[model samples]
Target: MSKHEILIVDDEPANLQKLKRTFLTDYTVHEAKTGDEALLILKERPVVAIVTDQRMPGMSGVNLLRQAREVRPDSIRIILTGFTEVEYLMDAINQGQVHRYITKPWEPVALKEALRQEIERWQLRKENERLSEELRLANEQLEKENFRLRQEIESLEPAGKQLVYESQEMRELMRLIDRVVPTNSTVLIQGETGTGKELLARYVHDQSPRADQPFIPVNCGAIPSELIESAFFGHKKGSFTGAIENRKGHFELAHQGTLYLDEIGEAPLDLQVKLLRVLQDAEIMPVGAQVAKKVDVRIIASTNRVLSREVEAGRFRQDLFFRLNVFAVFVPPLRTRRDDIVALSRYFLDRCRRRLNKPIPSFDPQTLALLRGFDWPGNVRELENEVERMVILSEPDQPIPASMVSERVRLASSTGGSDAGGLKEKVAEFERSLILEALRRHGHNRSHAADALGISRQTIIAKLKQYQLDDETAEG
Candidate 1:
């Protein structure tokens, strides 16, 4: 609501003074004696309108306006010319550089009117731009809320599938999913690869009213970036070179069902924006089609990467992350759920043997111990594969022994057992070195050494006793 500022440039002091007096009552007038000085004023202030005399020293009025165009292209420009040259007028009109032109010996009233008109025009343009930016932000907010409400409606319905789990970690995960299933909220399932994110997504789908519908799972990482748009939102025939037939996209095919976007963090940035728009508006325009089609699918996205970190690193969009992270469920890795290791191993073993027509006994105590101790970085999938491998290779009568376990598992077990013993030895050695150094620096004064190291004399004596450092010191 501040008054609009105007800049007046003229080599003549009388012209500059006369022009300033005309607009003194209307605007905050800034005067410049030369075109170069006027440009400096334009850079320093938000002068919406500029009026310059055509015959100026060094730079002409049209040239000044042209340079001003480079600095503040939005500012309205006017030129004051005494001679009516066709070429000068053509330069002003052709380049579309000057907004208005006035002749010398002009009436004060007419010049005032032109300045007033240009100022009003500049103000109107600024208001339009401001409103446009506001509208864009408002539309984005509305779409976000619209997407949220759509999910909430689906979530209120009853569930379809119940998950199976014995470990506290997975039980907690299921309980979290139970609360999330009835709402139309978007769910982001995060975990390491092979942590059963897809299984969990299926569980959520089965538990929800949408369980009766299809549960389409798309691995975003596996899809080629170029085909991502067509894969998510179908395309028209001849949309591109390879578009031979009409295809319903994943969103359309999964209508009224669940769209499981797995490995979602790997999706291309360009696709991420499109995906965000789809979530916001619940609609997608097919490639080569002018109209967008509506879709009704519950969104449950999964990713192995830390999406919040991805946002910080500029790899993922924050707005898209917010839309997809309305609800979150984290699948526990196999190593953290130790209780399930033996049970999962046995289940996979029995199922593998039944299929292969081989009867294998349960693992022996040593093998079971090894399995429990080895950290399963590959999670449930790795355990299942290993069990299947052992079943296919092992003798039917012999119980699965520790030797049957893979070298990595055996190495992990051996390393796991020695970690504590080796760490204690390393700590004692470090402590001995520190105490010796501190004593040597303090001239072997136990009290001074304790003070230097920020410990009590008694504590240092206890350390000396524990490491038997006193005997070595006595020999020295």
Candidate 2:
């Protein structure tokens, strides 16, 4: 994310420097010696606030600001004036959206505090506009769903919480989802934990033809082995002890809709066979039922583990893996999509601000910078949790401060912008860190690290050479 900006205009170079020093910590300061210079800057860059001296040589501050409204209508316009310029301040207020007017020879601390408040107000307004735009786009997409599937499913948790993407990686992922959703084939989503695989699956379902139907998400790892069959295929009344009433299993519940199998790699061998049968035949037999029932269900499965490795290790069924892998989508981790960090943060901040019913605006610029600096190992879920916590700790009518941010994030920023880099650099850093940790755990043995990573020893050797870590490897 780019830095928040403040434009300080004054004919006197000393005064401009003073004003710049006041906000150098919180904003990227732009200095101008004349109204024309400031106007030229406005054309090129957007600013959060414009502070101009009321008395200038040619064009007065009020006239310059009035003209600036056409360029940056959302910017907060302020004028530093003397008592003699009260009349000009009124004209500025009436003609432009002048936020405030401070008398000449103002206290630097007081002016700084006033500007911080206005900056927060500007940030909140911009974030709100962004969120409203997202909602508008979501409604438009719902309309394009052809108006047939717009009933109860409109309230599905994916509405306001849908995938928000700014990075090209996520944009390409969404495009792939669009291409595959029309096919209605079983989709296997792969990603690390907290990468929002389930949300992506629901998004895929919402784009499918069976959108209005129920979306049943079942965690294969959470169910006990004994009750697994009953949970998937259901049981008739009195099918077994404590089975007092008939139950509709997930497949039946999601008939004509989507059945999301989360953590699919954790499914037992028997369960995998049953899943493969259902996928092939589109039919299921209830426990203790005499006949099979046909059902229309689409499969969307997600797993954190590498399923191919799971199959090779005899922990997963090869046939089931093949069936689900017909269509695949990968949700990239947060650290790899650094550009989306600020956009997603603002999205969550808007949600939490409304839900809590507080006047707390957005995060201070430094706080946001610190947030971007930290590598979100837990991904989107962890970011949301951190935002919610910061919102709760914030005071009304103020932005969340850097002091309120998590200590780990603060520590990350202590290196002074060390996290500044592009996607390839970040991804390579993450991969290198993982390889180093794996080697450390295996006493720096490259062979064991390769095995644990599901790669050949030769490939690990190449990676170690590429990362210049060959010298760190364990010697036989």
Candidate 3:
């Protein structure tokens, strides 16, 4: 540590020498012959402690200590007063906040002990202040990071699972996803089969800062329980049944990149515990491994099941559910975003034609009407398949017919009901019905349905909110 300066004010030379010998080992001694000289030394240097004689020529020791208080509130003050200067001792206590009072011919050990205690108190106060400042800075940084993460999550909403829709809902989802892709927070995507949850996860990873690194997608449900650990945390050679060679786990492979765990809800309870530990600690221990390996991987988990319900039912870990739910992107189904059905159908139709090396064809008005009427349970995935089928069957220059759509979808659209209600009321009802139906179909792929429509994904999201559709129904 650096040396502390101690100012000694006394007109007598012998007294100054005595004070110097006492504290010379612990502090640098500055001798001031008078109170005025003591004040001058204090002005030029940072003194940690002050020792002064009561009787001085121009100024008294008490007055000097009082003035020093204004310059350095933290400095320890000591008054060396004789029996005759009892009044000065009282004055020093009240005015200078004197830390300790010493009398003439004081014992050497006692004087040293008093100075040591005061110095220790001063050091403790400084340390406490330093810690408080550090804590304040840390909290401020955390708040900023949280806000930025929220914004990034919001931006990703627009682009998420919206490739199938032509509605405003698709736009909204895209916007939210865009905002969230820049941060380091984990993302949770919830959608049904064929809703393109993996596709959206890839989109997020592609748009993130870690885009240049690997984007490893793992189907948690597809992996066998016995091999899950090896797949996730890697295994040493000869450690497992198939361990002819060492293998890097998903976490290691995705270092400085993203690890997309699809169907996370289906992970076994035992594996869930291991996954939680990795997320919490950023380190993983491979199967039969003695030590944990550190990895820097961004996790993006997806599921078609209701995780909260799964947690409540004891099928999934509550802590793990909360951790993954930090940021959720729900993909809507196809039927809910009916407004984009026509547009999406046309886009898919054109795409299919190009892929098949066939001329682009238009859909007849009846075919458009038939598509709008169908309640798509399979969401965008179903829609794309249907379009591909139509492209293959239809002639190069022929317009697609209403009969080309599945008989069930065609019957529902054509014979559902009359369209005589007021436009606003009818539109509102249509939106509500679509949202609910999409949620039921494709297991509520909000992102998929939103994309199928030509609108922003947020719009379909708002409808879900306005309609008060539960996740089970909206996503089912």
lDDT of each: 0.81, 0.82, 0.78
TM-scores for the candidates: 0.54, 0.56, 0.54
Off by over 4 Å in 2: 1-160, 416-476
Which ten contiguous residues of candidate 3 have the minimum total lDDT? 154-163
Writing each residue's lDDT as its tens digit, candidate 1 over 1-476 gives 57789899999899899989988888899999888898999999988888888887799888899999999899888888876654676678678799888877878899989988877787788899999999967964664455445545654433212234569988787778899898778899999988889878877887788866667788887888789889989899999999998777889767887899999999989989999999999999988899989899999999999999999999999999999988987888889998788668777776777778787756654566667777899988898888888888788856677678899887776677564554335335545766787788777888887765556788778888987886345211
lDDT of 3 by residue, 1-476 (tens): 88988888889998889888988998898999987788788889999999888788888878788888888778899888788877657765876468778888788789989888888998999899999899867864654455446546644543223355566777788788887899989899997776778878878987889876777788888888877888899899889677987677888777777899989999999889999999999999877789989999999999999999998899999999988988898887667777778778787777777668887457654566667767777877787888888878877777777668778776676566666434344445665665566556556777776654433578778877787776654541
lDDT of 2 by residue, 193-288 (tens): 999998899788878888777778899989998998899999999999989988878887777788999999989888999999999999999998
Against the true structure, candidate 3 has what lDDT?
0.78
Candidate whose TM-score is highest: 2
Task: Compare the candidates by lDDT and give the number of the best one.
Answer: 2
How many residue pairs in model 2 have overlapping backbones? Answer: 0
The TM-score measured for candidate 2 stands at 0.56
